[model samples]
Target: MNMSIVKKLKALHQLALSLTCSALLSLPLVAETAWRIDTVASDLDFAWSLAFMPDGRFLVTERTGQLVILNADGSEAKRQAAALPDMFVAAQGGLLDVLLAADFDSSGRLFLSYSCGNLNANSTCLASAQLINDELTAIRPIFRAQPERRGAAHYGGRMVQLPDETLVLTLGDGFDYREQAQNKANHLGKTVRLTVDGAVPADNPFVNQAGIAGEIFTLGHRNVQGIVYDPQTGQLFSHEHGPKGGDELNLLSAGQNYGWPVATYGVDYTGARVSPYQRFVGMQDPLYVWTPSIAPAGMTLYQGALFPEWQGNIFVSALAGKALHRLQLTAGKVTAEQVLLADLATRLRDVRTGPDGAIYLLTDGAKGQLLRLLPN
Candidate 1:
């Protein structure tokens, strides 16, 4: 044992300890912070979707027919948005989600989705309008699902605006219409891309197709209630409600077949087998599948500087699981999962990373609330 060798070994041990301490410092401190549930002065009437305005306020949509504004401190709430038109407030319908345009600060524009009805039929409609002084004006239907008038479920009413300035909207299979999901002629059970003003994007997958051309971006989705575009990777991610046991999270791609009734991971609500099998040729497999279904609703990829290490994580809100699931990923594959607010026992409905870099969540219930998760 040489004296020089001993000195070298001791130095290496010290270096290892220093590295370990530094790694610990970089880890998230989610457990250290006391989550303050601000119940007072909160008017979240079954709020579904939430988007932060550039001025630090939040625009939220209720499952009913109203849009409310929440101040930055959550201390004040008011009905800033006007009542929507022809909203079919039946089961799984009504006002679904709301989003502000990328240039909303200057344009004062916002988008909304809801089930529309008149003449004894109901259909899902995507509408856009100017939000002036908390009121919607110049409202126009940008897109509408075809073969309308089915049962009142599976609207798939969420919007994701891509960096290319194009907007994509999801539509469900319009209950009892399993075959429509595979039909390219209809907007039901499909993802459609359009311009900011509801015009079809020239580069859409079906831009030049024979029929139903210029709208269909992706086909064969079943009630995709959650959709988000990852800015870092420029990838689209969507989550949908399954019957009793087969909820799923899918990576969206243009013209790709995401087989719904033909190839599902879950069974029917009656406890009967829906799809013959989970895998099939040409069908895109989900990045993650939930067995005994979590009933996922909303999601967003974290990219803020508030939590540097959590920048790339995918945060999904689970209703049946009653928690927010954080998934760590590398190269578009999930490597680990952590369940947050598991003890809260609240059905987490929507999860989004705020402009302030904090994670905000909406709980699901008749009198649900808005929660913020900040790093301690």
Candidate 2:
């Protein structure tokens, strides 16, 4: 072959190699992002809430008044029968939420919220205890909803601790007493703020009001199940179930009335109007409303590395809707919505982010499951 032709052929070969390298670099390393159930902790008896400890262990609450500790791999380590509270188990009433104290490592303290009383007379109550050697010791009541009423449902038992170490407990309007949500004198349908020790906060919205409960922070909420605080913005957000329809997600503020039965987008279970209006003067509006009702349960404002794209989004567990709903938020407003894990055909009860940046879920059933969601 001619010398010039040989050199040209070598140059062409180098260019081809470079092109191949470029093409390989542009190819996707991972084909897709998918969510999958990583583990089934057990056939839980109705997993209501899940919280992770600093050592990567987790505790799950069952609505039947059971507290279970599981290893990081979802293997049961111990079950604390003595931790069970004397709960009034009935329709929507029972042992509800469990949370670890912010200083749980140092104090060994945990909190539980449940319905305490018989079906004929019950109320939402908060209690604290020390967990030592698989047992909850020194259990004591911290707060209890006042004007205990007769009912089998509507115990808003979700609890959240703020950065200030103050606690917020949501109370439901006893199903038959929806009107009491508007009354500040009772704890019904209100979010009460208290110190970790259970005393009413000195700066609570109604602390100085003569006729109002000193613990009342906000009122007019109907069975709020999901409550979370955004540490980045210092804002509290909550979602509650409405009658028939009109589930709501609200940006909570001190002293604000989030209109419930008096001003709702939903109607009575019989399809009668709950209220002829969805808004009223002096009452705050929801940041978002689910017209058909999703039965919003557990919620968390996600800020994790598992899904960089999901940063700053909100994750909600849906019971009636039986799905996980993601809301993309911008400047405190939801800009988009997505439904996930609907095909599982299970009622999602709780959602939490793990230290590893993975997502966890609890299913609601007689034989529920603790599930972890991971990228596929």
Candidate 3:
């Protein structure tokens, strides 16, 4: 070979090697963080809610009216069957939500919501009890919706505590009686605010209104299964399931009507229009609405340190969608959205943030699982 040609070939080889090194350097030094589920516990029958105790133990509620306590690592600690109330276990009606009191460390009190009544009729009910020696003590009823109906579905039973330590409980519109959601005379499809002892708050919007339920904080919801309070902004957020479509996320305001059957973005299951208007003069519109329905169940505001990028966003558990939805909110409005755990192929019944900043989830089924999400 000629000397000049040999020099050219060596230079080309060096250039190719340099290009390859540059490309390798541009690659990420470490893999991007991914979510991983650690099955904390399993074999739960239709677990509806998961809450952490002050001592790092966790409580899981089975829809069949049982409470299961687990160790921090998700091992079975104890099962309290007698602690659960006499729930009317019909379709979608049973022991629904369980929550620790804001002052649980000192008070030892916990609250629960469930369906009550016999086959003829049933309604959503709230109760409180103290967990003493791993047994429920001083259990008593706090509130119950009036005029129980025959319908067995749409019992909204989610609870959240406000900054003032007051409680907010969601009630679903009886599937057969959605019109009652618009009537203040009933508790159907309403959110109620009460003191820790179940007394109506003096500042509640409907306290002085005649013929309206004194406990009512807001009216006109379909079947709200998710609720959360943001202490940073003092805002309350809730999501409810709609008929054929029209799942909604609303910034809950006192005394406001949410326009369920009156003004809805959804249609009936039979493909008929739910209402002629999407916005009524006095009804409030949702902050975000999902058409075709995500069947939002449990929700939490992500203020944990495990995922700094998820701070101030909303995490919602979707049942029918079988996914966890991350909703980006800026100044009370949803700016963007993303879906997580779509490949899990399980109906996510509830999502909660643990004391250690990890995410916890409850799967809904006869052989459900309690899952913990951590950095992979």
Candidate 4:
């Protein structure tokens, strides 16, 4: 955030641009796997996330502020639109993550995160809603990233419910606010923990601390889009996008700083280094890093028995890389990695392990698709 550093970085960036760099990661090749792709539904408008209902029906979110319901076979069940709260729907903002409550069967309760506000000022917001009679109603705000930002980019809206039903949501650092990520006063570039009704947990790491957001669960993230709770080891993991390079797979901990602009394996898009330190004191290092970034988005731990080899492995969907990465881990560290379903060649937005032991994916585009990776 210093002017002198900014000026120096600009000059360095210009110099780097003038030189050819061949180190950018190329898309991984499609490899043989124990799965085959099957199209379940298509014609979605930039599908961002998904949640399955107890009765086999599922919900999918469209970035343009639409909540679609689909049958078990991926058949169109409804076309109704949930009321969007005047959200900014430009490049990366809009309706993002959708999740079902633990008591969804009877309570009809659900939660979603979206970009709320206009182009001039906006922030990521988490809201709770209900789906009754296939109609989405009773929408209410639970939390909003503090200090609204000016741009439409970097609203990381990923959500996950822990074993105890506490909700954890990801927030982006609002490109211009990367410096704020290292700060604890606001929600930018952090993960927040909250109760089902939007109450901040009294036991949160930052709770009772002055000058810090009580809801903050972790800090110093750039734009985390993929997060998953691994029940086997009782650990939480997330993967975030780096600038030009330095995509990370991290082990997340409450109140811990993961290091963003202050210490990163990535450089700015202009090719200027983001920081002098790639590993600094008082910051947690990443478990694995994907240099030349894959733009990792959606992730899920394979808990299904259908693929014995894939069981316990983490499956991450990539956007820019246009491939699904399979990472095998041991003690929270990646032991092996591979690319799956590269032949699809589309921006994958989300991935999940369904109750039926199949891997599901939502592609990103105007004609976004709901696809499945069925056992071969």
Highest-scoring model, TM-score: 4
Cα lDDT of model 2 by residue, 77-186, tens digit: 88766354556878787789988999899889989998998877789999998887767898988888988899788899999987777889998999899999999999
Whole-model lDDT, model 1: 0.77
Show where candidate 1 strays beyond 4 Å: 1-41, 118-120
lDDT for model 2, on a 0 to 1 scale? 0.82
When summed lDDT is taken over every stretch of 10 residues in candidate 1, the lowest stretch is 20-29
lDDT of 4 at 159: 88
Please, what are the lDDT tens digits per residue for candidate 3 over residues 94-117? 889999997788888999999999
lDDT by candidate, in order shown: 0.77, 0.82, 0.84, 0.85
> What ranges in model 3 sit over 4 Å off?
1-33, 82-85
- Quality of model 3 by C-alpha lDDT: 0.84
Please report how far candidate 2 places residue 361 from its true position, in Å: 0.3
Q: After best superposition, candidate 2 residue 37: deviation in angstroms?
A: 2.4
Candidate 3 collision pairs: none
- lDDT per residue as tens, model 1, 1-376: 2322213323433333333322111223233333443342254777888889787888888887778787887755568544567778877888888888988889999899888885357888888988887677888888877878657888888898877777888888887887788989888788888888889876676777787756888887888888887665556778888777767777676777788878887888888999787877987666667777888899989998777878788888998998887776655555566777888998887888988888888887678788888766
Q: Name model 2 segments beyond 4 Å from true.
A: 1-33, 82-86
Task: Judging by lDDT against the true structure, name the best candidate.
Answer: 4
Clash count per candidate: 0, 0, 0, 0
